[model samples]
Target: MQKLLASCIFFMLLAFGSCTQESDTPILVSTEDLLFVGGDKVRISGRLLTNQDVLATDHGFLFSTESSFAGAQTLSLGQKNGPGRFIGESTGFKIGQTYFAKAFAEINGQRIEGDVVELKTLTPSVSSFTPTYASAGNEMVIQGKNFPQGTKVFFGTQEAQVLQNLFESKLTIRIPVAAGQVVVPVKLVIQDKEIVLPQPFEYQAGKYTKVSEFPAQARIYDNTFFTNSSGFHVGLGRLRLSDSYRSFQRFDPTNGTWTEINFPGNPRRFAFASSSYLGGGALEVDRDVFQFDRSFYKINGSSFERLPDLPFNTREAMAVDWNGKLFLFGGRDGAGSVVREYDAIGRTWSQKRPAPFDMSGTTAVFKYGERIYVLAASGQVWEYLPSQDSWLTRGTYPGNTGQGFPFAQVIGKKAYLGLYRRTQEIWELDLETGVWKSKNQIIGLPQSINAGHFQSNGMIYILRSAEESTNGVLPMELYKFEPDAI
Candidate 1:
């Protein structure tokens, strides 16, 4: 009985030992986890399980677009001698696509594979872009996710230069030249997928043409400018402290020519001149001492009819014509905020309400509707109601005033202001809504000052003179501004 019992126990122990030996796999592979996933690449972590050190001729991962592993791509890890965790990476995968992956190992010419795992590549998308408005050659950045290699950007039909792409995201590109269009849609093409950005990009749309050189060949500064039925006229400014240019020149937009016109009144500098009236200036200079001129006149088609001389004298005063009356505001010589009115019927000058701040001929003032909008050097936009003779702060000027002396020309209901001394910036102000928008900067001569400006038929004509520091280096030029042009 004892022998029979011992035989049964021995058989049972042998069976248990056989089961343990069969359970010890020589080389086993497991698809542990996906370490990372990207637009076109993925890193997979895999494990090789074995009871003892087993030589694996090859170990790696398999990736394929099909679940059946047909036409699968292999990421071989060469060879392995021990059982442990292994990692492999596969690239050149399609973005926003689903793929199947599995870990595998080869031992003794036999193949071992783990369970297949499914993953989807990240989709490429754009979030936003900076600087909706830019000029050609300006750098702009696009923020997004999963921007694959060989991504293309376009501004309308023009292809932009790609500067840099970071982390398969965030693209920096150079703005392309505008193809005679002010605003254009921005688009991106990635891997045959086209994307149009929500907001369209605007190109700097100002075209500057040197219409003609100043025929006077003399740099004019602090001059008087006016426009009438005939044309635009500019004159009456000092070439130096003791020398002044009294020659008035007329520019005809119809023929694109300039003609020197005659003024019967004595020549003077720092005078106030509007459409039909001219008065008050510093005239004769004796050893650098100025004598103010108070003679007034009414201009009528190349002829001047003398009117009553001004009651007081001031230099560089702002003048405008409204309701058949000549209105002047501010000047040098302690007349900073004074407002004076001369009625054509009465032929007499009367003092009106004072301006809100100091104003001069250099201050940018334009007539829109029934109000005179004054742009102060301090970036304040003052609205003056000519009817009520009252003033109110409308809004703030956004552009740089620089050394002051910016020009304001109104065409229709829009006012174009800027080109302040030593600055090339120009801004457009909506007289009706009081909203300001930045326009394209002037083409050249940033260190230039405005000599005179007048508008005709929705186009603004400007005369540019060099600043004092840049005198003689930059020629006095006439520019025709198509405010709404591309």
Candidate 2:
């Protein structure tokens, strides 16, 4: 009986030794069948090769631009079943970019990585196509990646004539004349692969036409304008001789006439204005600085009342009203990207997040929908989210940034922008798509600098003064612009 017990104990020891040997074996992982699923996307398949009593606690594919796996992005297949095949997917790969990927598994507490596999994503893609609305004979540029020498482009079923295949990423093509106002797909075909832009391009129907001119005395540059319930107000500008004026005026679109109004504050330059949250045709003005006075004021009827002073001296900053609060962004405070917010009702000032970049001479700051936008002198466009108190770089402005102050006014879903530096060209930007279209040049108005732009009752008004001044005053003129008529 003792001998039999010894033999049984020996058999149990053998079974235990076998189990420890199997669990101590190292795990093997490998990646296979990396396939291109289309633009900027790929499918990765991987498998574990070792069998163990404890399944893999973690398994997935690791990928990155570099092979070191430092700062690499991981696709986690959490608690995956071991010794079997698993699949994972990744996206947002740049066109024509090479990536390194490896399969990994964690068993018991050890992480085991597989051999690195190299992958190259397909290059054919379209980043952006300009002139969303165009006419036949209009030149359009398709910007993207991986355009082979013989790649073909199409607008709907009509093929566009390629004017210049400049590079692998840029193609200049003349739009084919199509039926007016027809929405059509823009297609790019390379080899056997084809890509269609998500947003269809529209063929424009109307052309730019001249409208009535501004009926008031033209004000010099740095003039302030804001829209109110009654009409639009224009006032407070620097003369050509560097002297400031307090003459204020308002335009009534209903009668197409301008009336002089009392401006109670001392003449100020670079004063920013916005429609007053309080009613009765009142407007708010801030950053008013000239010779002796630098304060905030509210224009109520013929009287101007002082408000709380700005936290700091700010000039040339962009101001916009959001939900009854005033937000000032990037001006001449020596702070590269300063952003300040004011609660008019509470008479309090608070600093928000700065802009993404310096906005010293921003062309325009206006609100559309829930977001506020800033167009800087360097042609960079940024969007500010009040809820997030953060800024996002919205594509660059695709217009001529000449030596003039940037002026922009939003009317509906479109914003009209132009530089006053001897440029007759006006650009229309679709706020929804961030696409810019060059409209017809302003006619019946002389080229001027530091012009003020304001929109009221669906009509855009451009206030300009003579470039050359007589005595200290510049000949001022205001022109009414009807975009649809153009």
The number of the candidate with the highest TM-score is: 1
- Model 1 pairs whose backbones collide: none
Q: TM-score of every model?
A: 0.88, 0.54
Off by over 4 Å in 1: 1-24, 240-242, 432-435, 444-447, 468-475, 484-486
In model 2, which regions exceed 4 Å deviation?
1-218, 277-292, 301-303, 444-446, 468-474
Supply candidate 2's per-residue lDDT for 174. 90
What TM-score should be assigned to candidate 2? 0.54
lDDT of 2 by residue, 1-486 (tens): 322443355456556656787655545666756754444566887777654645788899898989787889888889976476788887666656778888888877998776688888766878888988766789999898767566788888888888887646789999997743367888887666679987898775324332334443444556667767666677776555556656767777677667777776666666767675211111124343223234787655534687755556666666778887887777664755888788877888899987768875556777889999887777777888998998888877676777647778888999887764667667788998877776656654445654566777776777665565434433565677766542
- Evaluate candidate 2 by giving its C-alpha RMSD to the native, one decimal: 20.4
Model 2 lDDT at residue 120: 81
Instruction: Please give the RMSD to the true structure for each candidate, in Å.
Output: 6.7, 20.4
